[model samples]
Structures are given as C-alpha cells and as structure tokens.
Target: MSKALGYKSFGGSDVQEFFSRPDLTPSPVEVLVQVAAAGVNPADHKLRSGEAPDLNGHLPFPQVLGLEAAGTVLAVGAEVTGLAVGDRVTGFALTGAGTYAETTLLLGAATARIPDALPETWAATIPVAGTTALDVLDQLDLPAGSSVLVNGIGGGVGIAVAQIARDRGLVVTGTAGTAKRDLVTSTGASFVDYTGGDVVERLRALAPEGFDAAVDTVGGPSLHEIAGLAKVLVSVGDQSVTELGGATVERRVDRSGLERVAELMVTGRLDPHITATYPLAQADEALALVESKHATGKVVIDLRL
Candidate 1:
C-alpha cells in the first residue's frame, strides 16, 4: 500500500487526512514513481477548499494533493518510451493520484530525466514554479535593457522570474512586503515595499517613463493597481488580464522544456531557493506555509527526511 495525504471532501484543513491506498497504476502515457520530494503551492489548498472547480470539478473524492514531484521511476506504461525503470526524473503528477504520497503517476510527455548534479528537491519545483516563470517571460518576449515590473515578486514563481529577467539583461523591479526586501533585491532587481506608504507613487518614482512590460503574480486589485504602469501586461493566473488587452501566461509542458529548465539549474542560472522543507508526516504544515502566501522562496516536502 502507498501512504498518502489527501482530502476526503472539498473544504478546509479539517478535511485533510492521512490514509493508505493501493499503488497507483500508470496510464498509457504515464509513469509510476516512488516520490522522494514534492513541491508545495497555493493551488493545493485552493483545490482542497473547492475554490478551483473548473480544474477539480471532475476529480473524485479523497483526492491526493500535489501537482509536481521528483523521484525514481518505478515503472513505465507501455506507450512511455523516453523513460525506464530506475530513472531519476521530475514532472507533473497525474490528477487525483498526486505526488504527496509514497507512489504517484507522472505524465510521460511532461516528465524529464534530471542531471546527476540536480537535487531531487530542486527538480521537484521545475514542473510548476520554474516553468511558469519561463512561460510568462517568454510570452512577454521583452528585449534586453527593457524595464519590467514584477508585481508581487516574493513567491516561488515571482523569484524565479526575477532571476531569469536579470539573466536576460532586462531591468527588473518588484513590490513585496518589507520582510521580503532582501530576498527580492538579492536577484539584482529593485525592491518596492508594498507596506510602506503609497505604492503607485513609489513605483512611478522608480520608473517615471513607465515599464516596457509588467508581469503580475498577484491578481485582482493588486493587478489593477499596476496594470497601467507598463505598456504590456501579463498575468500568471488571472484570465481577467485579457480584458485589459493583456494575455495570461501560456504554459507549455513537455520533455524538452523540462530538460531546458533542468539544464538552467545544473548550470546555476536558476535557483528555486527552496527556503523550507518538511517530511511527509508533516505535509499539512508544508502546505500551510505555502497557502499563507508569505513564504519567501519555495516550500517542499522531503520524503527522505
């Protein structure tokens, strides 16, 4: 049996429970993995709380709660040719059969073998936060020396974006809580403390001519406040961006993209930061930190711990 952390019904943390179940079977385009580590995100709690019905509406009850993981492949489906048993890889976990467990299913096309130098904990973050950063930047396609504003630039995806923007030679500026001032500025990006006085005036003073583009991780009012600061706008998750003549980030999940991101990490061009980790027994704690939206960097569950 595989031990897992999951929710029996859509609600609050009270719905989460630990249970044992049969090992998940891979589909024709899937791979079975013995999870060594899993990445935590705000989406996990959102899905568990029934906030994302569009994505979780079809899922069954007692669904496992994780989107990305890294581990050794235990088995591969008949149609899965790129991976073999015992391969160390990372990718998106199959819906319902999540990575927050002893065993879970990863889609073959989205999975990529990790380099020997990359730790499983870091690789586990590539499938989601890492790639999301890449996609948002690629969608914007800003040229070097161009200025860009990263609204809400303290979370996992936000930090990744700032680092990559710096590498690409784009001028980066971001707004975040005072506690994250060091973390945001460490990437060579200018940091704007959202809690200190008027944010709009502060941003205007930094880039009076306005930014070439703005990539928003915080939606709703935060996004609205910064939308006009840049000529181009792109949001990571907010579809409402389209109404403002901006496009939401387009995510492309494939083996090649995963390999490219893994290479960046191997070469030290990208770092997940991964400020916190927890054991499977403390899965809820790991997720709670991420859900709080105040985590400095990535939060991961280390099964090996």
Candidate 2:
C-alpha cells in the first residue's frame, strides 16, 4: 500500500498517519503521478487549525492535507491527451485532492509542462507562488520601474514574487530575516530586515515617499502601516490585506493565477530555488520547520527519497 500523510483530527495538529488504502484509478480526464516533491503551503496549516473553510465536506477520517506537488506521470486515463507516461509534470492550483502522498492524481485543471532548463524542484515551485505574486502586481497598476515593497521575503511566495516583479524591471525592496536578506538581494532587489518591530518606521526611513506597491506575505496589523505607505497592497495569505482602507487589496486563492504561472515557468523567466529538502516520511519535521517561520526559502518534501 502506498503511504500518504493524512490528518486524523483538526485543531492545529499536523500529525499524519500511514494507512493502507485501495489504489485510485485515474479517470480519462485525470493523470496519475508518482510524487517527486510536495510544496508545503500555509493553507495546509490553516485547514488543520480549523481556521480556513473545510473544503467541500467534513474531513474524511485520515484526511490528506497538501494542495500541490511536482511529479512524473505514471499512468494516464483515456480522456487525457498531451500528457503521457514518462512525462515529468507539476500540479496546478487548489482542486486539492491529497497531493501529499507517494502517488497522487491530478486533473487537467492547471497542470503544466515544466521547462527543461528548470529543475523539477523549480518546476514545482512557481505554480502557486508565481501566480499569486504576479496577480498582486497586476492589481497594483504600477508602471514598470516603480518601487515595490515585499514583506516576508523569506517564504516561497515572497521570493517568487520578488523575482517576478524584478523581471518586470521594477525596483523591489524586501524585508526578511538576516539569513534570507541575502537571498532576496541576490535576486537583484534591495533587501531590508523587518525581523524587528517598527517595519513601517524603517521602510519610511528607507523610502520616505513610500512604494507604488506593497506585497505582504505575512499578514497582520502591519498591513495598516504598509497600506498607509503604498498605493496598492496585496496579501497572499487567507488573512485580510484590507486594512489599507481605500487602497487596493487582494487575497490569494486557488484557480486565480496558475495559468500565467505555468506560462512563465514554461517559456519565461523562473529559476529553481530549493533551499532545503526532506523525505516524505519526515513531513512532520518539514511542517515544524515552516511553522518556526525561520525557513529562508521554500521547504519541499522530496517524495523521491
């Protein structure tokens, strides 16, 4: 029996149990993949904590929690075309049906062909983060070369957003921990440390006029100050970026930006940035690391191990 990390109870518990189950038959419109790496998202924790909406029905006993993975096509159903066996693939946004497993199934929903130049880890990286970043940038309506402030630069989405915005020729400034400050700077953007308090005061000191756009990956009351300083504000988490009052605000969700992300990954500029890896069996540790909020970049569960 193939093993998967599943949620046995709600309320902030990330514990998953291995259980035997019948194999899933891939439908004609679906493809079966042997998961290579799974992306750990903040939503995974929110759902477990009973904060986000429980998708569809109540949790099935031993519920699986991940929403995205990059893997190879192991089997294909009749209704599927263009994708076939031996094809290396990455999953799309939401439509989450237990991707944190040795084997997972995906519909044609938002699956994209990964570029040859990009590694599987990178191919897996952009689907969700890239889309969210670009979407928020679009909402900002900022002209090219405008200044941008990216808070929470250490996480997967923040890093991806910074790179994408920089590619658009915008001046990007990011706030992150000292360890991640360099990574954000290496992407050809300015790095600032807000790991301390009074981020607004420091940002004001750096750019007294404020930025054209502000993307807050870590949402909280800090948005109030970010909104005050920026023309538009974007939040990628489930929480509100709306504290900005009259300023533009956006909350990231599934099915909103993956297609654009797919194109960028396939033909445009996106590179691999897998900072750390963990085996599927050690997913608990992976979640714990992310929960610590000290991870400088994407923490992927390497299912291949």
Per-residue CA lDDT of candidate 2, range 1-305, in tens? 66887666666653556554557678777788887888877767766665665562464666676777788888888877677798787875233356678887877545655655656666566556666677777777677889989878778888888877877888988888878867887888787777677877888988999888788888776555577777766777624555454333353443336556766665756544677788988887777777778877787888878
Writing each residue's lDDT as its tens digit, candidate 1 over 244-278 gives: 88889899988887898898899988999999999
Worst 10 residues of 1 by lDDT: 93-102
Highest-scoring model, TM-score: 1
Candidate lDDT scores, in order, read 0.91, 0.71
**In candidate 1, which residue ranges exceed 4 Å CA deviation?**
none
My TM-score estimates for the predictions, one after another, are: 0.98, 0.87
lDDT leader: 1
